[model samples]
Target: MARRKTREEIKTQDKWNIEKMYPDNASAEKDLKESVSDAEKYGKYKGHLADSAESLADALIESDRIEQKLERAFVYSRMKLDEDNRAAEQQALYSKAAAAISQVSSLTSFVMPELIRIPEETLKQFIEDEPRLQTYRHLLDSAMRQKDHVLSEKEENILAQLGEVLSAPDQVFTMLNDADMKFGKIKDEEGKETELTHGNYISFMRSQNRQVRKDAYTHCYEAYKGMINTISANYSANVKTDVISARLRNYPSARAAALSSGRIPESVYDNLIDSVHSALPKMYEYVKLRKKLLGLDELKMYDIYVPLVKLPKKKIRFQQAVEIGKEGLAPLGDAYLQQFQKGIDSRWIDIYETEGKTSGAYSFGSYDSDPYVLMNFDSTLEDVFTLVHEMGHSMNSWLTRKTQPYVYGGHSIFTAEVASTVNETLLMKHLLKTESDPEMKKYILNMYLDAFKGTLFRQTMFAEFEKKTHEYAENGGGLTADWMNKTYDELNTEYFGPALSHDDYIQYEWARIPHFYNSFYVYQYATGYSAANAIADRILNGGEKERDDYLKFLSLGSSDYPVELLKVAGVDMSQREPVDRAMKVFSGLVDEFAELMEE
Candidate 1:
């Protein structure tokens, strides 16, 4: 087996040029420490937020300056650590950054509660009275919306001081999963053995070789199974923390707190679950069709990812994939494509998996830095899709950072997912329209169907599990390894239906999902995919106005409520129609795929 390369062994071009953000660790540490004094500047406005319009505007602007510096420091340190989790020096740098930010949080904890305490009439007049305060109308509005959940200043300060302690469960899980857990090795399709890592697990599952798929699945879950007890306890602690924090702030439930923070309606979450439940029959039909197409008597979990309609194998290498992505995503217009190309040329991507690298992909950077993407590219067509997906996120950041102020410069997961998935949608549409070969077209169709299955059906199931488990903890029930496994397994069976033959490996799945620690975040993938489908259709079928609207939406950042911001793109997420429409699309695609396979 080939040994995984160390960080230094990876090619220079394949890594992100993060040095542009900070020269070295010493510089990052220096900035982090200096930001401590900047945080203290907030003390000057503590008692005088409601004193006058000018004072209020000045305080908010000063806060933005301090936050920008702190964010840059935090982002630099974390990105450095993400490159190699085992590096002690990087770990220390990250710890210092986290501590610095937490201290800043402690120093400025009075800001939100104090803002909330101002009378609404007074606050409105302050905005009307000060022209400078116009920049913060939405910010103040958002704060007022959450006023019911704002605790006393002292309590807020206490929580800020305990920030790192409250984050212990997530930190413990990260260290254990990324640095400690090992899945050993598995035999590849040609009987050559290869090391099994998180980056290649999905590739193994999609291997035409069934035994390779089964082996990868078994080894991956078995490692989690070994640490299930610890994982369950750690996850329980995370849930407890979330519940207690929400209760302390007077939220009805942890879910309510999560949704309300972004001004999203709880009905949107429920609508996703309810709509997907109605569509599960179609999912079962697809699974049954998959079993028939594979000529298998029973479809096991490992059998799900292998493409049902086989196309000729071709290696889509990194450069080729980026070119294809450029072509596929060209419909987003020249301005968007130009920035994407610049990102490509500027070394804004870290492209490949190496020893001790964080698994999965993300687009990350502070407002002052280029939006950078981290990927594990194995040159599959699916990896091309991933490249475009993360680039979508980076493009969103790039546009938002250039156009919006620091306060609205980031994304709520709600709108963030839409940006990423829109790229995926456009890329798929491009492939389907341009590819001429019958088999290749069939493969593209298969990929599209699987995406719907994964995002709509699969993520909704995950959303339900998150909801149920949180409710369990809220009701004083223990989330032991056995109970979580049982709950997750039942959900799998319910979602996958009778076509799926259960395995022990399938139930341990929840233990391995890092997203569970993120609370109600997974549901956005489903919601966003739904919204993207609509937006993509508009751009393709409608006029230049439709394209302009989406571009504007991407630039809006968090300037408005997430659902309202999505309206700028012509998709209303508050209604269930988007999910219903997405379900219809899935149903049509399933019909098309089954007919092609049967032919």
Candidate 2:
């Protein structure tokens, strides 16, 4: 193995040109000061929002400006900090930016309640009275729609002040998982001492060496098991916070409060869970096939990630991955393709991992800035897929920023994953159609199957766990470690079926999942994957109309509701058809993989 490069050693072309957001720290600080001043001045209109249509429109526009500025400063500082978290100065900059944002949010906190206080007819008249306010119609309407849920001004202010306190659970969970928990070390298949970490745990689980996989799994979970009590307390606090916050806001349930943010109907969440339940037999068939393919009498959870067929060794370079992604996403048309290429050429990506760099990949930027991606690129097929995935988000942001106003320029998390997963689906289709080598074909097919298993099935399992835990807390039950563990274990058994054996430590897996801190967020992964598959299929086979509609969806941002936007792209997520279609895709992939293995 080669030594990893430092941030300075990586080529300039491969790193994101975040200097576009700010030329230097000095410039960033300058903007931060300006933003604070602007926000302070903007606060003058807080109590005067309902004074007139012009007053309301002016406040909204100024608020938008301040937010856009804050986002640029914040993204730059945060990305700088992420590049090397150990740098104290970068950390300070990030902290300052965060504080500035919180200040602005605090200043503007009264805007919504004040607007909501206006009569519904008066607010509509305001929109009609001021043509300029027409640009904010959706924004104003969204606030008005929350009328039933909006509390009094004093209560809203109190909630705003408690924001930091409310976030304690997530903050504590992050510290424990990322900064404090230690997984120790284990010997790898190569007989080298390897450090066990959250980052590489999944890779170890996928090892062909069963003993190595089992050791890594046991050791990793053992660490979590040790911290189980503390983690459970923290998570329980998080659940209680969710329940209390929902009740305060008059939402019937925490899940309803969560889903309502993106205007998603509770039916969509229930439909996903129900549809997944109906598809368990297909998942069971896949598991049984895994057991037979591995020639094992019993399949363990650790055995789930190993590839069914050994793929030919093919190392894909960063540039090669970019070319492959471009080909895969070409169906979206030339303009979209050009935008993607521009992002690549303009140093919109930060490639290669360095010491202290953040783990994993993400696409982020402000409305005024170019959509940027951060990646720790290693030359593997997985890395290639991730490249396309982040690119999907980047392109979506790019299109939305270009087309929508600042207020609606960003998308919700509900629709965010759809863009990224669609890219992965298309990439898989491209590889399978073009690759002739049997082993390589099997490899890509297996990757597709694993994606479904992980994203669709595994996340749905997580979704179920989140729902149950929240329900338990809502019913006046305590979320003790044992209760969470037993509930998780039962769900694991139910989802994976009798074909797989669960290890004892596997029951504590919930303690290790960071997503649990974000209330009811994982369900989007399942629904978004399903929606992506349906949209990708249409774009690939349904011709120009489909491609145009999908592109239109990407440009929509928050202009319309997520489900409605998806419908425009030919995927109605409210119904069960999309989930069923995705399961059929999963079933077909399993059949193909089993047949290919026999050959």
Q: Number of the top candidate by TM-score?
A: 1
In lDDT terms, which candidate is top?
1
Tens-digit per-residue lDDT, 1-599, candidate 2: 22346789888998899988888987887788889899889879978988999998888888888888888888899888778766789878877886777677666678778888999999899999999999988777788779899887778777876676787797577656755677888887788887776556666787889998999988988898998999999999999999999999999999999988778998888888888888899889889999998999879988999887776556799989989898998888899888888899999999887766767788999899989999887677788899999999999999999899998999998999999999999989989999988888887888898899889889999999999999999999999999999999999999999899877988998887888888888999899999999999999989999999999999999998788889889998888899988988888888878887888
Q: Write the per-residue lDDT of candidate 1 for residues 408-487, one digit (tens) a residue.
A: 99999999999999999999999999999888899999999999989988889999999999999989998898999999
The estimated TM-scores of all candidates read 0.99, 0.95
RMSD of 1: 1.0
Please report, in order, the local distance difference test score of every candidate based on alpha carbons: 0.92, 0.87
The regions of model 1 sitting more than 4 angstroms off are none
lDDT of model number 1: 0.92
Clashes of 2: 0
Worst 10 residues of 2 by lDDT: 171-180
